[model samples]
Target chain A: MDYDPMVMDDAESLGPVVKISQADNVRVKFELSNADLSFANSLRRVMLAEIPTIAIDLVEIEENSSVLADEFIAHRLGLIPLNAEGAESLLYSRDCDCDNYCEHCSVKLVLHAKCTGGENMSISARDLVPAGDRMHQTLGMPVIRDEDGLGPLILKLRPGQEIKLECIAKKGIAKEHAKWAPSAAIGFEYDPHNKLHHIDYWYEQDPKTEWPPSEYVDWEEPPAEGEPFDYDAVPNRFYYNVETSGPLGPDGIVTEGIKVIQQKLAGLIHELTEGEGGDNYDGPRSPEYGGGGDGFGYSTSYGGNGGNQSAWGGAGGTTPFGQTPYGGGGNTWS
Target chain B: MNAPDRFELFLLQDGEKKIVETVVNGMSNCSDFTIKKEDHTIGNLLSERLKQAPNVMMAGYKVAHPNVPELFIRVQTDGTVTPREALVNALKQLVAAYGQLGREFQKELALRQYADQGENGDGSGAQGGTY
Candidate 1:
């Protein structure tokens, strides 16, 4: 309960890491200086809502003989977590130059199936096929998969039933929809303080007082002096957990979430400082200006704007854009 | 730790060691585990470190559910290394790098001198030099 001005100014730089532990690749635990709880919570929110992952955004159904309706099927498809390895290189639809959908901004997946035999069958995400030029990398890729190689079920079909549909996957954040959330669950808690109380000594003197969890008393080697219990203490340090929804590993989700936070901070700094003093205001500074330890205390040498690397990187391409998600009246059956 | 079990002991604020157990090992491409603590800082830090590990294909962690307070992390790695090994390496590397950064900061502070030469001087922090 002592005042320390230095603690507020450079807690990040000066804080000590007291402990760290991990359970293989699945979970890790670490303890550092207790700072603002809100700041720690912000990191959790960023991981759940800001990290970019690929999900089905627009769907066009040509035919449906299965039980699920077109809109219902689209909803199910949107929740699938696609492999987002190269998504950072791709541009967000809002940032793209195209008026609507384009190859640079979207991936096309088609699913066509029919039950010809007498036996009923189940349909899974594996049945969905990535179409067009990007097929090689995306074929048989599920939005998410379990360790057993099983994907979420899309629909079940009886004999003679069929379904044909086209889905467009795009990079987005969970703020848009739950489907884009990188993690299914995430949370953190404050570290607790413990104290030993000499209950036996107090009980012997005052027999009227009652104690719960009676086994806690140390009868074998009772100390001459009682240890003070810190029940009222509020710990500043926190621990958190992240359960991945499958498109990426939990670690990847956290890393991407941190990057997104850094980028947003960088964007703010660029916006506020760009036109202030320099008449040489370039159109828009690359988000990379925030790199090289701009805001985050550590050095991040991830050069080159940290955006998409392939098709989306180009500007003024002749590739024609497709119809808007809602502008087109109905699905184009072929 | 057996093939199905891996555990880590977390040193709590009260100096009590709590063991976090792995309930589900993602054999093919995932691993799921639980910890008693409710925390975002540790999970975020570990995941951030894992992302920088070499040969790590994908790494992820999450709370089990909205009602549950346990944490789970799953990591996938290239054939060259196991996910568990990759995570340990990441933590070691981060500690070393951060320690080095602290020393660098101290050195810079010692070498540089602060001056308050008023508004007459150009305020730009830029220094001119031939690379």
Candidate 2:
């Protein structure tokens, strides 16, 4: 057996035997070592903005006499996290053959709450339930629940006030709207003790007190006071603490983030190889969801928006008709 | 801002060479390449990976300006393989590594009996990792 460098880049070469140190429903913590900072940052970016999740994209309110405006209520609904366990199995509405939206692409949820008594009634995510003719499993239901009925109150209804609405949940990436974000905040840090001085700290009295050292200082050796910093050092290991918003699990977010990044690279590789003439393309192009192959169909909303700003002239948005680079088997890199 | 912007980096233009080979001013086997519409994401990662190859003499990348969405990578190899081939291999390896990581995560999840979602167990809300 010959030495396979790639396979050999396992536990020993990885330099750390650490596992995901902490994990729960809404958060996950892990260490990424023997990796480049760019790779770590890229993964963090994808998890924050590219990983897809289900959210209330379109809402239709039938009756609303509550104190809150219809738009306000709808906006709150959008922030609520819906279980996105099998969101991968659902097709982007644009990719589906249906005219508007179908069961294959959209999940309909309805909220009905009325305050008929004198006491004020609270409207929460728990009040929202599956609404459809067919079977609605727990997969797409809201994940948040508490003693006070899925607490994270949307609004309070007064006596004689009522609200009735239907929500259409669709798959989308955070790049489209933050409502689809998988995590609220991704705690990413490297060189915790500033051994490399990647950043220059400002100070009036003491730099330590002014810009307090990262709590992760314990992870790295504290730079000796007044010791010369390593000018040529580059960030290699990283710490990732992902706080999910409940739409997806932290594990799901991390795994899906990797898959999305692979798809992006696969998409680019496909373009690169196809441009070089396909016969020599030996890179793996696994057909995964949203992958340029497999079931990977790039939805229009998957690209840039607002602060993200990486439109690339809209990767899947401007394609001829609705043909995505991954969806069209006949389409070339052209 | 009139900047090329981040997401615009991913959109490849027609007839545009994503990666281009340019002759170094007066060096043989030493090459400088420009990856259009990219940033440190590709430049830094690819350069770091290239440096690990025994054939690669030196590898580094830089961006001319924050506004410019171009990645400049300079690679010199020890006369065995072309810098272009080294770059392509390193890039593909990075992708493969990501795939490997995904499988490891799934394996861990499988050990935990798989899909233990909705537990929403309370207490210990403190954030912790590598501590």
Candidate topping DockQ: 2
DockQ scores for all predicted structures: 0.02, 0.21
CA-lDDT, candidates in order: 0.50, 0.65
Give the per-residue lDDT digits (tens) of candidate 1, residues A121-227.
Answer: 88888888888656226422575445655588889899999999988888776655678776777755553211233233446554435434222132123333555
Write down the DockQ of candidate 2: 0.21
Candidate 2 per-residue lDDT, tens place, A49-118, comes to 8777788888999999988898998899898888776666667775577999878878889988889899
Poorly placed runs, candidate 1 (over 4 Å): A1-4, A9-12, A15-20, A23-34, A135-140, A193-234, A275-300, A303-334, B1-131
**Each candidate: RMSD:** 23.2, 9.7
lDDT computed for candidate 2: 0.65
Q: What fraction of the true interface contacts does model 1 reproduce? A: 0.00
Q: Per-prediction fnat values?
A: 0.00, 0.15
Please give the TM-score for the first chain of candidate 1: 0.68
